[model samples]
Target: MNQTRRKRRPDPSLSRLDSLSPEMLFPAKSPSLTSSRIRYIFLLLTFCFIIYIIFSYGTTFRREQISSIARSLSVFSTRRRHLLFSIAASHDSWLRRSSYVRLWYSPESTRAVVFLDRGGLESDLTLPPVIVSKDVSRFPYNFPGGLRSAIRVARVVKETVDLGDKDVRWFVFGDDDTVFFVDNLVTVLSKYDHRKWYYVGSNSEFYDQNVRYSFDMAFGGGGFAISASLAKVLAKVLDSCLMRYSHMYGSDSRIFSCVAELGVTLTHEPGFHQIDVRGNIFGLLCAHPLSPLVSLHHLDAVDPFFPKRNRTESVAHLIGAASFDSARILQQSVCYDSLNTVTVSVVWGYAVQVYEGNKLLPDLLTLQKTFSTWRRGSGVQSNYMFSTREYPRDPCGRPLVFFLDSVGSDGTEGTWSNYNLHRVGNCHRAEAVERLERVRVLSRKLKHDVEQMVAPRRQCCDISSPYNKSMVINIRQCMPDELIAMNT
Candidate 1:
């Protein structure tokens, strides 16, 4: 086996492989392909960083923007200087109706212009400046028994906007005879956003009138408001819109149609009173809605506000009371004295009703039918917009009445209003309430914020035991969980 062993030579292929360089085993790629791959990786990393940033800080940025907007809005609360009034009137009625305007108009503070059919009148410092309406002869009218002057009245909206008043927030429209509680008007308008479109007012009290015209229409006599933003747009398109609504009967109807064309509807406020009724309005004034009294219309059609005073004097009396505390005017408050079995309802700055037994608050809030219907008819025609209870024809069945005698401040944030007993029918009254000859109500001036105006709650009142032929009542905010009911 040893003699057979022999050495063999290496193969030619193996010797060639061992001699090759290191570059042959690992090769390099082109520069273009390598550069493209690097760029793709960089782009993906940058996109992920951007998405993380947005998720971390986007909500904070949005919150800061909203805060800035709210601060700007708070700086400009509505004031008397923010309103511009355009009163529609005629030369024939101006002399008589101007008196009504003077009652509420303040030469120094109120900004108003009376739009008359004709100009050329003696200048009076007591009245607002007068402007003759632009001729509206071109507009068409097809309604039977309707006046063409409605076109002129409707045009007042355009003419007022053209005046170019600076810093005006609201443009208010009213009839010459309409009486507005300006302070209360300002309070109500402050609750709305003037930057948006708004149409604020009320309809007629009579159901028939609403059916005859439109339940959605805001009666012009009651007065109405247009936000400055909406007024500008409405003024531009009113003429063309008037051409389309030529068949409408009243000026308010024309304005309503034009506003409707813009996709806006009436924003009803119960404070505006059309007073579409006849005879005494005692019941209406006594049971006013739980809101500030904004405006009153049709003073000539109804009896004087007070029993003995003339029409103008009666209105002046109410206005005098309003001058002290307009926000509380006509606000009704009910309370009961359980020990004496007596119930009393106080209409601040207006009147007072004293009942014998424990009367429910809901029953006292209903309107008493002391006045007749707006139209002479039966059934639906005589119906009213609100709930009403029949006023007793026999004086003996009625409660004791008291009318506002005077009102004044209490030298602080508080104020006092005095009411004198209005002697009526010689009816036998309950022992607890018969001797009451006067009522003195003590309250603080109402200053409501936006939240309170949005969701108003009825105030609570406490009555002091009757003393020396007089009674005292203190009105205050209700306590949490308090109920207005007779004590068990």
Candidate 2:
């Protein structure tokens, strides 16, 4: 029995050592130590993830906070009633005037005053607007047929001011082609008291002919606003003033000259855009502005402001979208294109296609990658592209970085890829490359121009006001030559 037991036990060294598992044999580790190592790795990963999240969403958070505060304070709420006058030509095709007329014909249209040419079926037709004929007998001043409309401006001012609604604080005037963002206009006017005489408007000098007019003159096409007090003063004296400037080349310059006689200088407001360009102004509209966009003129020739195939639908859509918070829209909306060619950046939640005249040579993907890496390294957080779901896809068929995708019920958010038909197509690679290069160059230049426009600005007219040295500065009035000389 003893011999059999010894055989079963075997040699202690060989049996115990050889039969034991590797873990047991090699100095059994503390279970606590293994758990501690795992904990350490988990903590490191968690910290990294937190940092990434903060970096991505910090700006968006701050922007939203600012917007919330502004809304809470009711900075945009104004008790004053505003009256808008849309000047229209009688002979112009209905199609040409239809868009602008229909634009103001909303609940807001109740406040608008529309003037049409006399002796036509178009003039006789009743619309939503407060219809008024461009009656020659309304005022005594009439020079040439060309200046006939110009002569009527004072009459319109007189008619509006005479209505004597104490609530009416502002009288705005614009061409038939002008499109007003009513909310923004109200915000701008709220900064000034209606009791004081204020002539607010923007200037234009893209053309050499613009130099012929007073540098201080506000372009009428861009639209101009007058305080109630000033409108009253003008109502009494405008006919006399018109007689003096009857020979002036343009109505806007003549009006400016007349206002100068009344000791009221043009209060340059950059929000009003006089878009005199013949082609699409997508870039100009999409770029950041020094102030809230109040109006856009000359919509007759440019591409529709919104992203609809039908021009009429685009205008209607734009008017509808204008009801939201302008500041929040500007900050939150981000748009980009895949052709890497033209990128339509959203300024105030509005984007217009921007094409470049010159082509640059750079790999768009490479630039994007570089920018991403730099942003990460710098710890700059971005939540411009958001996904509520665990997994998000780019439907626009564009590179993931281009535009933001809409958050949906399916637990995912992505761009509407079907909308970008041109991007995913089998277009010529060479052409695509060329266009992309142009876009790169234009984007860089546009960025620089925007920076310059928004930099610490001092107005030529407001020398008493301290020069601001902030990133978000108002558009300061400078000599017309300054803007005219720019290659942009």
Stretches of candidate 1 off by over 4 Å are 1-71, 74-76, 377-380, 466-468
Go through the candidates in order and give the clash count of each: 0, 10
TM-score for all models, in order of appearance: 0.85, 0.54
Model 2 misses residue 195 by how many Å?
1.3
Q: Residue 43 of candidate 1: its Cα lDDT?
A: 88
lDDT per model vs. reference = 0.89, 0.50
Model 2 C-alpha lDDT per residue in residues 1-488, reported as the tens digit of each score: 45544345556688577677544544335653365666676699899999998778779897998898875554334542455454544445444675675664555334665665544444323443444554655444444555566666545666666667655677888777777777667767777666678999977624333555666778888899988778888878867766676676566776677788889998888788776554444434434344766887777666664443455665555555444333222221222223333322223334312222222211211111111111233544322111111111332333211111111122232111101112434434323232331111001001112344346231221111221211111112356554211122
lDDT of 2 at 407: 11
lDDT of 1 by residue, 131-234 (tens): 99998998999889999999999999999999999989999999988999998999999888888899999999998899888999899999999999999999
TM-score of 1: 0.85
